[model samples]
Target: MKGLVIGGGVAGLRAALDIANAGFDIYLVERDYSIGGRSAQITKSYPDLTNIKDVLKPLMEEVYNHERITLLTNSEVLGLEGEAGNFKVKIEKKPRYVPDGESCEKCIEVCPVEIPNEFNERLDKRKAIFVPFSYAIPDGCVIDETNCLHFKDGSCSRCKEVCDGINFDQKAETIEIDVGSVVVATGFDPFDPNLRPELAYDKYDGVITSLELERILDEDGPTGGKIIINGKEPKSVVFAHCIGSRDKKVENPYCSRICCMYTAKEAYMLREKLPNAEISACYIDMRAFGKGCEEFYEEVQKKQVLYRRGVAAEVYSNGVNLVLRAEDTLLSEPYESAADMIVLAVGVEPKEGSSELAENLGIKMDEYGFFVEKNMYDPVETEKEGIFLAGCCQGPKDITDSILQGGAAAAKAIGLMGRHSN
Candidate 1:
């Protein structure tokens, strides 16, 4: 059977590889120029402590090489029609401007756009055209439309003027395909830290997200694994938990399963690299539920890392310092801590397009836009037969649970194919 998966994240990539291994033709679509979704932006995973791209590289290689799989990068599923056994998939693919499969390094060197990379949350800057990261799935440069000179009044095409491999005629194309099964695992987005004004996230130059901090601590990231913030090494760093997550009134009420583990891991990593700096994780009940999760958290606690059970009520600046005001529930008293930098373990919300895709396909999603299952026992199988939900698209889950869901999605997809007696 021919199947189409409309996401290139961990879960979608995992499903594509497994189902393709089962002898079915699979078409994998990714909106980004690369296949490894947000996970690609991270340096490592927690609890087990493994590099994210190291895991993605092998899976991506499989997706790239499988004879039964057709990979489409820099594309989005524009529309869906028909259902169940047969359907038409409409896709919109934007151009990379660079010639397909051509090695183009000079373009990046010559391009004039020098803005912070969105993928790494502004930790670093790359030219207008750049691989999302050094180890990006395709490992090639991409043309960012927003900053491209072609869109900015056509004044400079220095990249094109330098690159001998570009094609001026490369235009976006919308194509339609026929498929028997569909998988939607578009994943989730982090809550905007700026929305919570009391936190004064954007107002201050120091506060950042768990994702952004991950990049900063990464050896390959902008800071080269340094605990520096705003041009200086911070004497103290504080991680505030449940910033945009686990709070219904602010951003989301979801647990964002990966937060606790990441927070603990961040604390540990900070201690490993900055033994002299003060570190504390301000959280409301650390939810460490994965295998060896509790032990890892204990390890961070034993490192003289302060585990203050509390939610920071507000953050404001004081004479070149950021002040956190909150109640330390364990002490049952209000307290304030001055920190050089703040890391917000902002919660993960469903990726921006999850709902629009669900509504367009007539698939069921919860009030929050994650794929809603018909029953909890069958987590992968959604109300739409032959279509499965996996990863954070269903709810807050760590990488372990997401990988398990990936395998389960493959099993569910295979079972549906078997029912057709093809």
Candidate 2:
């Protein structure tokens, strides 16, 4: 009996690899053009500050090159039927237009259409015919039909003229497969800070989300790893925590679980990059519950990052700098802190369309749209016997916990399939 893994993020990759290594044929389905989900967008991991590329690259390479794993990029599960021991699955694979292993990169220069690069958090523009990143796994250019001129009005064919690999005629197709067990690893999306307009995330040029800052700090990122705001390096930076998490007004009352530590890490990085810049963080409470995370938080404090007990109440421009207004809970005094750049440490939310997917799969989701597990003790198992949950799809978690759950889900899948084979 074969196995199936969905979502193709770090968690999905881990699940597929673990199951495949156990001698099971596994099909890995990823909706995106590339396999490395949101984890690929990150610059570094917290606590250790290890470069994420170093950890993700080798794992992605191993999965792509594995013999027992069939990677289906730009694909989604359409339907599933049958029980734990046997199941039929249908998948829809989208056309990339550009043939695999055949990009000369000349097409990118000739393409007339440009759009916001989502992989870079819209900090830069990319041609309609372009790759998601430098080392995207299925390394080839993908034509975004939504914005491509050729697809819109057939008025432009510059990319096809320059490169023979561009095939506008390629069409999407469907595939059917059989698997004994399924693993859902669909990940989380960062909360939209615009929900809280008081922070002025949409109106200000100086305010950016933490994910955007990750791209800025990346060596291969939009700004080439420079900590620049408004085209100039900021002398002071302020971080506002819990923008979309732990707030009843937004209806997201759960702690995002990673914001505090990540903010601390970012502040530590900022200090390293700009030793003279003043750095401070406005927070409601600090929860360093992870292993070694408390030490890391203390270490960041030693780097001269001022941590104040408060929540950012408002942000307004003073014509010269951005002013953050908040009340220090301990001191019982309201104060305004001025900075050239303000980074909102946004929280994680369930992936959009998660409810639809859960309903289709005959599983249950919480009010917040996270997949509900069989029980608190059996976190990986779903209501359906053969189906399992992994990563942030179950809830907000850090990278380590996501990978851990991925392995746990894989083990459950292996166990069920092993018994069926016997």
Candidate 3:
């Protein structure tokens, strides 16, 4: 009557902790080298501007230190069989190459291979052997075998020579376990703005996605939290909302549900950093539905951040500054706004491999690829008896809703397991 939770984001963490505290053994599986998920990558949470690390780090630590919880990083569920109350699961755990808790970081400084650091949204370069972030759970460096020279042609051993913790011989292992119920908390991926090429996301240095902006706002981030664009503070910054959401052109017509408020939050933070810099946002609509969110939007407006009704139609550089063209739906006038930096308020999408995972777990996915639930009233319960849904894997949602769903799923799992035991 054990429990299993997949995806180690905040939602997954909450599910695991809840089940563990309910006196059930639970296994938490994360596909990445670390377990923090997208929440760890963010600088702050909206409406209240709470430092995300303060919230995430303690939760991660509690999960890692919990006796009834087995934190499995760099792992994925390979298969699930049997029925509710007696499910067999197989997990594939990839080797990190660097031993956990034994990394001296000497390998990083000696490694010659440099690749774009995805953790920082490629704003900086990292050695082939590196950790995902400063506070990554199961803290240690991981070797990117794809880019490591030693794996290519055995051409480099600098990292191995500098650190005794590097283990080139380690291989992936498969673990089999039996659980009463499974919770799918695999999170969402930020909308790739490149899909909308007219915005010139890849064509200009001044353009960046909202997630990238989060990294830049992080003090521990690549630029040391400086709002520097092109090596200098910008005179103006403009945020464009609904890049991949609420648009029929991309087939993602659903509102992302968080972009408007987050954009407002980012604009508010930008005002704090660059008090004299002109700040404005172009949006299709203002949806501040969460608790305190509407008030926060008003606070941002008080900070002198201008909000206009429109969606960016096109973005191009005019040899000096990046120019954004849009139609102000409010005034029914075509306009162009030039800014030193343009942040795209990208939407959320289902995780790329969600469909495959749903099939593997014997659950249904909606047309949009989010895991289908039992009904609107029972949002956390999946169509499958032993399976439950949590977080954005079910659909687009903010952190607060994600956590609530996680707890609901955990309670469902615990009840099922308890009934089976009885």
**Per-residue alpha-carbon lDDT of candidate 3 for residues 186-233, written as tens digits (9 for 90 to 100):** 999999898999999999989999999999999999999999899999
Pairs with steric clashes in candidate 2: none
RMSD of each: 1.5, 0.8, 0.9
Q: Candidate 1 lDDT, tens digit per residue, 283-312?
A: 898898888999989988999889888998
lDDT for each of the candidates?
0.82, 0.93, 0.92
lDDT of 2 by residue, 1-422 (tens): 89999988989999999999999999999989898899898888999999999999888999999999999998888888888978898899999998887667999999887789999999999999998898798998999999999999999999989888788999989988999999999999999989999999999989999999999999899999999899999999999999999988888999999999999999999899999999999999999899999999999999999999999999999999999999999999999999999999999999987877886678899988999999999999998999999999999999999999999999999999999999
TM-score of 3: 0.99
TM-score of each: 0.96, 0.99, 0.99
Overall local distance difference test of candidate 2: 0.93
**Count of clashes, each model:** 1, 0, 0
Which candidate model has the greater TM-score, 1 or 3?
3
Q: Give me the overall lDDT of model 3.
A: 0.92
TM-score of 1: 0.96
- Superposed by TM-score, candidate 1 places the C-alpha of residue 276 at a distance from the truth, in angstroms, of 1.0
